[model samples]
Target: MFFSKKKNKWILAAVVIILLLVIAYTGEKRERLTFPEEIVMYLVAPAQDLFTSLGQNIQTFFASISQYREIKEENERLRQKVSRVQEEMVDMEEIRQENRRFRDMLDFKEKQEMELLAAGVVARDPTRWFDTLTLNRGYRHGVEVEMAVITHRGVVGMVSSVSANSSQVLLVTNPRLRISAMSQDSRDPVLGFVEGRTDQREHLRVKMDHMPPEAEIKPGDVIVTSNIGTIFPGGIYVGEVREVDVDMFGLVKYATIEPSVNFNRLEEVFIVTSPVQEEPRQEEHSADGEDVPEES
Candidate 1:
């Protein structure tokens, strides 16, 4: 609707008066809020409080994430340290065991009268593990074919083949190996021949055969090398008799021998190079067939 001229002038005058009042109100400071100020604070207070709370929550979330990351790193470091310590303990235990073995071997070597060569077992044929062993010593170490191989415990085997740096030992468990053995009882010595049994290979047993039917050999009898053997030294321990049996016709007797050496755990061995030679004794005689007189 169109306003009359007088009305228009009155409207313009009212707008100008309102502008002057606003300018005066803004310039003057008051002790309490104006109606407009109160209305603006009422509208903005909840939004401002919400933004402040959200910011604090975000800061707390980031802090928690950082702490968790540090804890995870510490745990990882501890786990690695524990693993290294465990590995070191295992290595130390291995060294201790090895040292003990070496000491025992050295003591045994010193007590023997025969020329002994120390050698370590290095390998075995998977198919004939129970029947054969490979030694780290060979011709270069004075090892020779048919040489007797013995450990501190007892007889092991004989050297079958030799190389420049390694030798193959025919274990006492092999059927092809044989040793002349006898019972340890001097009063009733029971002579026999010991050889490995093909049928009893799974049990790692040997057969002491050729014992007379009337022989007094029985269970728990200690079998030892006899003077008849050219390869092995006399008096060397062979094994123990576990069982004795007579033939179907009762012509011969046999005994089951459990070897003194555990072939499965064979690690170190000694090769008999030769028997130590002894100096001949000189005989002293008196010219009168009486005690020799000492010169004063």
Candidate 2:
């Protein structure tokens, strides 16, 4: 009870002090309790400084957040741009490799001893089964009928027909195409012709005819052109012997040849021009006639 009484007395004293302060403020005639200018400065200046510092700190925090977001967004954009450029660089490298391969084919054609004409494969036979192609070069390019065409790999075909600016080539795989070929090791010649067979299911197959009975023909033997016909040059690589068979009669032997040039995938070819003979011609005289000297 004594403690409670003391608490009530303290509250009453606080109320009285507050009422007096209110009355003094309202009564203008009463002398106001004034503090010196120096004392006012000491009381209010610290509070103002605290409020100003809080506002400045809040602004700086927000600006820093905004700057971080901008930097993150820019980093993402730059990464995407770099990835796109890398993909384009890969595509350019592929194109460069393809161009190099085409240039190598051109160089091989240039190095050949034969007089050559270059032509691109423009079109293939509509009858997809036919081993034939149309060339961009023709009569206008001095491409003549029956001229042999070859790629860097090996023989491709012979010119079958010609238009003004285009020509048709009968591929080596064509059934009508025949070539005299011989083994590189023995130089023993054989006659081979393309056969349109479905067996062994390959790009091309040649039926070798008139293989001598005594000749030892084997698989993996390289076959090249012989001087039997005027169509292709002698010693031009044609194919390799893949298989051999002797008929029941035992009189004739046959072999299968795999062409060195893939007709189904030919892209470009070279046409060989006829070689000019530089030697002078010789003349013969009758028995009674005097030998006539040829003019210089």
Candidate 3:
């Protein structure tokens, strides 16, 4: 076994010496590579080319992945930016609509006979839903109890209670409120008292009671305050006649009226002040002893 190991070592040394001699001889040559060297180079060339190409392909793939990630991040950022812009547009549109409504109200006030005091609705009577809403104005602003409150569409209510800074309005949609209503048509000559209906919720409607049997009430007929109306001003729009009903005796008739004012969407109102009739008052004071100003 020892002699065999010694023989293997000598064979390895001989191979190393032969490789050294071949390298030295090749280094001195200026001519083309020898046939053996050419064959060796040919065998390794394809592997070297494959390794260089694989490195280039790997670098390209990594670069493409990084670029795609950047694009995805940029797209997400753009989507968020668009969403914010749409939200802002919606808010601006809402503001624009509010301004338009206010403008229409201003125009309506200009057409009124009495001085109109514009006010915003601030609260509602919890027990009655939209039957009663509170206004930002009160006695201090010349808003008196029983004064008619109106909107651009039509009459809304009467000021039922008053405070220094706020007042409550009894909406016409309330069951308690009754107004003498008349048909706008000169031919029909329909007259009745209007009262609010509570059973329905979709639309604010009123009952026109004690309609005359001969009265020819019809749908789409515009109703207005009659001359008999004491609280509300005459000719103020009330509602449109919807359905007509007759009693079993055929002596009395009633009709349903769709109110012109949309109480559900009430946001603002104008209080109608009566014309000053009495001799100029000496001083203005509320029943509660708070000094107030006279209507201008």
Candidate 4:
């Protein structure tokens, strides 16, 4: 067994010496590889190529992940910027509309015979929004109870209650409020008292009651306040007659009126602090054929 081991060691030394001699001879000038070198290269080349390809694939995967994260962040930033721009646009439009409304009110205030105090609607009765509104002005601002509330278009309501800094208005759509009104027609003027409909709590409508039996009131006839009321100013627009009906006893006639003011969209109004006596002028049309409130 010892001799066998010795023989194997000598054979290994001999093979090493022969490999060194072959490398020294071919290192400078070699046309082709030896058979043993060719066999070794053939076995190692495929494994080397596989490892290199795997390294390149890992680098490419990491690069794609980084690029995707950057793209996602950029999109989120752009979305926020767009949202901010849209909000700014809406704010600008709202300011423009408010300025226009103020200009119209100023024009009306310049032409009025009564003392007009501008007030903003601050609150609304949630349970009776159509019936009542609260204003920012009160007795401190010359706003008093029973003072008529109006808009550029026409009459709105009456100040029902007052406080130090705020006041409540009883809208014309409320059943408890009443206004003495008359037809605007000069040739066939009819007299009646206008009051809100009891059954129309959800709707904004008023009825002119106590019409004469021979009253020829019809639709499209404009209604205005009469001098009979001590609270409401005379000649102020109330509404237009929508339809007429006979009483159950047929002894009197009544008419439904569509108010000139849109209560739902009321934001600002003028409170009549003091009014002077004036004759009701006939309703007129503008050059554009639009019905305009005749200035008193």
* Top-scoring candidate (lDDT): 4
Please state every model's RMSD to the true fold in angstroms: 14.9, 15.4, 10.8, 10.8
Candidate 4's displacement at residue 160, Å, is: 1.1
- For residues 258-278, what per-residue lDDT tens digits would candidate 3 score against the true structure? 889877778888888874333
TM-score of each: 0.67, 0.60, 0.67, 0.68
Better candidate by lDDT, 1 or 4 = 4
Q: Which residue pairs clash in candidate 4?
A: none
Cα-lDDT of candidate 1: 0.79
Worst 10 residues of 1 by lDDT: 278-287
Best by TM-score: 4
* Model 2 alpha-carbon miss at residue 128, Å: 3.6
Q: Which residue ranges in model 4 land beyond 4 Å of their true spot?
A: 1-67, 276-296
If both were scored by lDDT, which would come out higher, candidate 2 or candidate 4?
A: 4
After superposition, the stretches of candidate 2 with alpha carbons farther than 4 Å from their true spots are: 1-94, 187-203, 275-296
How well does candidate 1 score on lDDT at residue 41?
85
Number of colliding residue pairs in each model: 0, 0, 0, 0
User: Residue 230's C-alpha lDDT in candidate 1?
Assistant: 56
Error of 4 at 273 (Å): 0.7
TM match of model 1 to true structure: 0.67
lDDT (Cα) of model 2: 0.70
Candidate 3 C-alpha RMSD relative to the actual structure: 10.8
